[model samples]
Target chain A: MHELSLITAMMDLILKDAQSRGIRKITRVELKVGEFSGAYPHALREAFAVASRATPMEEAELVIEEVPAELRCRECGAVFRPSETGWACPSCRSQNVLLQGGLELEIQSYHGRDGDVGQGRSRQGYSSGEQEES
Target chain B: MSVKVVVGKDILAVNRKRAEDLRARFKQMGIKVVNMLSSPGAGKTSILEATIPRLQKVRAAVIEGDVATTRDAERLSHLGIPLVQITTLGACHLDASMVWKALEEMDLSRVDLLFIENVGNLVCPASFDLGENLRVVVLSVAEGTDKPAKYPAAFLSSQVVLINKMDLVPYTDFDLERVLGEVRAMKPDMKTFTMSCRTGEGIDRWAEWLEKWVRESQ
Candidate 1:
């Protein structure tokens, strides 16, 4: 499935960020996956474990946030959450609503050890890359 | 061990970027490009065979992508249009790099419409953008009606869905209504047309759409 390839891409991005910031370990990697993004979260989790082995994210916790599908009504310009049945604008009852978001598959943050401060700034502390714990 | 974290997002982002570049190039040349995606045996080739004759005045070109065999390319070549075959050598989809290569080798200076027939796989091709303005997906009635639900990625990504092989609907127990419903459920606004490329019924509607697209693009 395409999820295997997506997992590899995610890992590559993680590795680049860690190397650039000089972060020693990644305790958690927070991600937001949209409901209509065509990505299976369970399959991605399993694939992430295998692909991240031996990397700094090996012991990293993956926090997957499932973003519901949303649509912005073309008529009223109101944003509404899409239900499982269909996408409809709640404000104006318009079917001409364009997609507004929720298809996000982004690595919001990575937490573990904070990287060294740059540009002679004070240390940002452990919360620098802090992800939402719960 | 410092964890260098990067978020590449979709694995096909680079491919998409390349496709966009190709799109810009096509626009500069004033060409109407259509990216065709579908499952195997959806009569994609047959649709092409039926379409080329209708577009004789438009001067179209085709770029065929497949894992192996030049059969599709050969068939398109027989139609007397410039055709190039890009063999992925086992890859499930055609990426932008392959299309770039095909564009370089083909004499498309006079070509008004470029039809890029992608490798016949419902899953992977949806993720990759081939730099075409319009994406057409063909679904044969011989396949189950549940295909749209099962393969939402392709249907959702496509602008038009051609329900092919309508002639077989009578002989088989395929539910045309359910299939159309499923497709509409996934993409509520997608333009769909039911046709038999074999019998040449409803080919004119598809051709008219293509012609309108070309005229508008120009």
Candidate 2:
């Protein structure tokens, strides 16, 4: 499905990040997927495997943090997460709750060797927004 | 060995930002953009084809989105209007970034009305905004009337619900009243139009309403 496309986009960012830090190999890639985002994690992993072949992230481990569904009550100022069934604010018990968050997907960080680390191989402070890529 | 990272950023937030920006641009240009969404085989393309003839007087352009086909654009091209085809490769829904790229490629200077036909799906498309003035959801009777109840988000977010394939109502057992009730349950004030692109029945009312809305928005 679209997971493959999303996986490709993620890999593009990861590869770019990995190359920028002069990293030889990627150990792990942390990601946060939201509940309402409709991204299938299993499919994404499968897509990642295909997209990561022969790259610095060939053996990269994907760590996904699934964010659950959350809603905000319109009647009351109560914010809560939805249960297994449908959306009903847990705090104020209102059905007229608007969805607030949990729909997210991001590349958190990666662990790998960034060339020689001076006296000690220290972890690099890597972030997508902080880096500019052409 | 091991690393723990926290990425609390929202991926869709980026798209939403772009969609908002596009909406602002559309408003400034006085373009009445309509982002149309529906399930596969829901008559979205057909409705667009039907709507184009009635929009002859208006300077309208179509931005067709699909997984990997230019057929929809080809269909609209027959109407002799500016059309841009966006192939998503494999994405289920069309996001704002792709739309921004497509919009940049299209001739938007003289366009009064812009129609963006999203990839056919009632689920994923609801979560993404394509910077349209109105999000119209098409529901054909052949698909069943219970769709509004099952997929409330699509119905709730839509400004107009075009109930298409009304001519097939004779063959199918779709309850028009029940579908209307379901849509009203979620959105009590939603406007709906029932028509068939095949027979071109009841298309004028929809076209008239759309024209009025476009004029008002401009």
Candidate 3:
């Protein structure tokens, strides 16, 4: 599955960052996968288990947070979760809608042990923008 | 001791950056790039073979992606156009980096339109952006009408949907209205084209629209 490729890419990113921060071994990884990101959490875990072997994340715990898909109506400026059968705005019944969320596929953070002091440390990768809903 | 790192980074950040760079290059060269996606045997190559010749005024090039084999590449070799083929070996989809590498093998200076035929898959390709101006998902009548509902990622991300192999519609249980209805419910603004590559039906309108789009991008 393509989830393997995604997991490999994610591991590369995490390992590179971990190495730079003097992390000897990764203990945990947290990911935010959106409903529309085309990646399933179960598949991701299976991929992670396969991709992390012999790497710093060999024994790491993989945590995934799924985000629900949200749509914003352009005509009515209303934000709501799309119905299973349609994406039309519930408020004004407009078909002019934009996806407001549920397309995210990102690494939120990681837990590791520093090589020198053997102390656990946490690093913030980047700031995510506020997702506003109406 | 366990430490936490805040890595609020998009998983495909590297690929996205490369795609953005490719987009800038395409824009600079005034090339309209169209990325085509579909499942196996969905007539992507057939449609291209029939439509490219009708492009008429537009100068076109193609970068074909396949899991293995260059058969698709050979099919279009008769067009006498610049073509490059990327055989991914085992990768299920083409990332922007692969496309970036393929571009280095071709000359796009005189190309008005560039068609990137992605690996025949509806899933993984939807998640990877190749910096194309338009994304088209090709569905054949044999694939059934429920494809849009089953593979929403591909349908949702695509701007255009081409329902190919209309000649075989009577032989299959494909419901055109149902498929269009589902697509409309998901994406109301999506442009749709129904065509039979064998009979050359509906090819002219698609080719004309494509040519106009290419010219407008220039």
lDDT of 3 by residue, B72-146 (tens): 999999999999999999898999999999998999888899999999999899989899999999999998888
Candidate 3: docking tier: acceptable
Where does the lowest 10-residue lDDT sum fall in candidate 1 chain B? B1-10
**Considering just chain B, what TM-score does every model have?**
0.95, 0.94, 0.98
Q: What lDDT tens digits, residue by residue, belong to model 2 across residues B1-218?
A: 23233333444455667899999999888788999999888898998888878974678899998988888888778887889999988788898988899877888888899999999988778767888889999999989867865565567678889999999998999999878865664455789999999999989899988988888767
Q: lDDT score, residue A114, model 3?
A: 47
Clashes of 3: 14
- Order the candidates by lDDT, highest first: 3, 1, 2
> What are the clashing pairs of model 2?
none
For model 2 chain B, give the 10-residue run with minimal summed lDDT. B1-10
Q: What does candidate 2's lDDT look like per residue over A1-134, in tens digits?
A: 56765776666655565555555677778788766565768988898898889988888888888877566778797877655444555666665666566656666666665444232323346442332221
Tell me how far the alpha carbon of residue B132 in candidate 3 is from the true structure, in angstroms, after superposition.
1.2
Q: Which is superior by TM-score, 1 or 2?
A: 1
Candidate 2 vs. truth: CA RMSD? 5.2
Of all true interface contacts, what fraction is found in model 1?
0.10
lDDT of 3 by residue, A72-132 (tens): 9889899999676567789998877887788889999887774442333422332442111
Q: Model-by-model lDDT, in order?
A: 0.77, 0.76, 0.87
